[model samples]
Target: MLMETPRLVGAFACLEYSFPFVTMARRWFVTATGIQVRRFVPNDEQGVSALILPIQREEFGIPITAEDQPDLKAIPTFYQIGTGDFWVAVQGDHVVGSIALKDIGSGQAALRKMFVAAPFRGKEFSIAARLLDRLIEESTRKGVTEVFLGTTDKFLAAHRFYEKHGFQEIAKEDLPASFPLIAVDSKFYVLGLNPE
Candidate 1:
């Protein structure tokens, strides 16, 4: 017998996801509501842009545009090269979030393009966490030893989020030479799969 118990709390969506035989990993799965997390498909480019651009430009006050970021125009060639890939979270036809891993060679990769809409940015949704977890898991499986990322100090919430998920703060000098350092990203972080 299967049971479907639904409860509402204030303005938040369903807070409990009952799993009869699921492990902790599955616990982080984007099972909240009808949102589905998956790899980036060709059609997702437009949606990805729409979802990420506003977050970076309007919300974060970054002066970047789609033109400055050529990688967005060529995610397959830029991000899907070697062990790198991009992912998006969607509900119906709308993209709610996006994340990507760029293989920078030397057994290291760079985490990029992590953006979740304001409506979906909280523990209630776990969109950011799921995206980060997915990137880390996939990169590790592809033999990526360490994941490097850069961010501006403006993203205090993002810094906390990354740190909470095992990413350690590192000086810019510690980053690999091949790492694609973003101009706006002043602070840097790294997470090693095989920590020494």
Candidate 2:
């Protein structure tokens, strides 16, 4: 049976079963620039992939395939487990950006898969900031005391963006044992959350 629930413009909601096996999709209203950041749903797999993969491979010249990144293939299984969560910034039906937090235990999490499409980036859209804010807010609520992330030095703009948002660069040896360090990760950063 199909069920309807009232949801806030940009809020996430549980899936509603329509035909015993079919799931009804949840929709979020258009925000200021016709974009809304919300939690990942199964239907978002393709959109998320389209938004992230090309940026990682084509734009950055990373010699990697989607297969090498298991998290991208199964976001819910990889990110939604434990305190981890993944989010996507959607402009209408297209996913324009994405960010994920992978809980690494000990009140800590690993930030991953942060990518914004070229058209949606910059100060006007602030898509990256929105995605980061959502992830940080959710992480704080789940008692994640610290968040770590690894990135390639090639991402100079990303480095500046992360630092601008209070992430401090740290050495490889400083990373938590559970932080998943990918082969391409040459630079690392950490953000400490204040319980206050």
Candidate 3:
């Protein structure tokens, strides 16, 4: 279910899956904060890269380039298959944030490419939350029972945000085999969509 209100709309949605054992639907939403989150389109790749690569390389001081990640060029094929999709946050004509879910078979997904610009990082913008809200909202609709993610240990704030949003810290060995592993990933998390 998706809930929206007016232009610069308020949004909420809940998605449900059966394979994880006919679980209850979980609802999440984003308040209208003047940031528009939408599905990835052909034209958005450059903007998406412009938003993410710098965050990975400069903000986080990670040693990588756009070529290091093929998904940056093959968004449609890599992230937009089955229940998976990528989303971007637009402020004016520029892309400021991103989040993506990759259907990794079974009832699981790998959350990837979540990044937000420095200016948009906190409660004032909630850009990260908006991108995540969009991803989770779609995950339930596609019947994904659990969402997993990998992050670097350097992202202390990101760790807190993920924990605050219900993702429990998990060991690398505990992640699903299909969950895409990143060389830089030193931390992992999982959010169960169904009740235990």
Q: What are the clash counts of all predictions, listed in order?
A: 0, 0, 3
Off by over 4 Å in 1: 1-31
Q: What ordering of candidates by TM-score runs from best to worst?
A: 2, 1, 3
What C-alpha lDDT do the candidate models reach, one value each?
A: 0.79, 0.82, 0.79
- Candidate of highest lDDT: 2
What TM-score, computed on C-alpha atoms, does each candidate reach? 0.82, 0.83, 0.81
Per-residue lDDT over 88-170 for candidate 3, one digit per residue giving the tens place of the 0 to 100 score: 99865556789999999998999999987665667877889888988888898779999999999999999999999999999
* Native RMSD of candidate 3 (Å): 13.5
lDDT tens string, model 1, 118-195? 667788889898888888778878888999999999999999998988999999999999999888999999998952
Q: After the best TM-score superposition of candidate 1, give how far the Cα of residue 161 lies from its true spot, in angstroms.
A: 0.4
The Cα RMSD in angstroms, rounded to one decimal, for candidate 1 relative to the true structure is 10.9
- Measured by TM-score, how close is model 2 to the native structure? 0.83
Lowest summed lDDT window (length 10), candidate 2: 8-17
Candidate 3: list runs displaced more than 4 Å. 1-33
TM-score of 1: 0.82
Tens digits of lDDT, candidate 2, 1-196: 2222223333332222244677566453334467889999999987777667667876788987777887887999999989899999987777778999998999999999999866566887889999999998998888889999999989999999999999999999999999998999999999999643
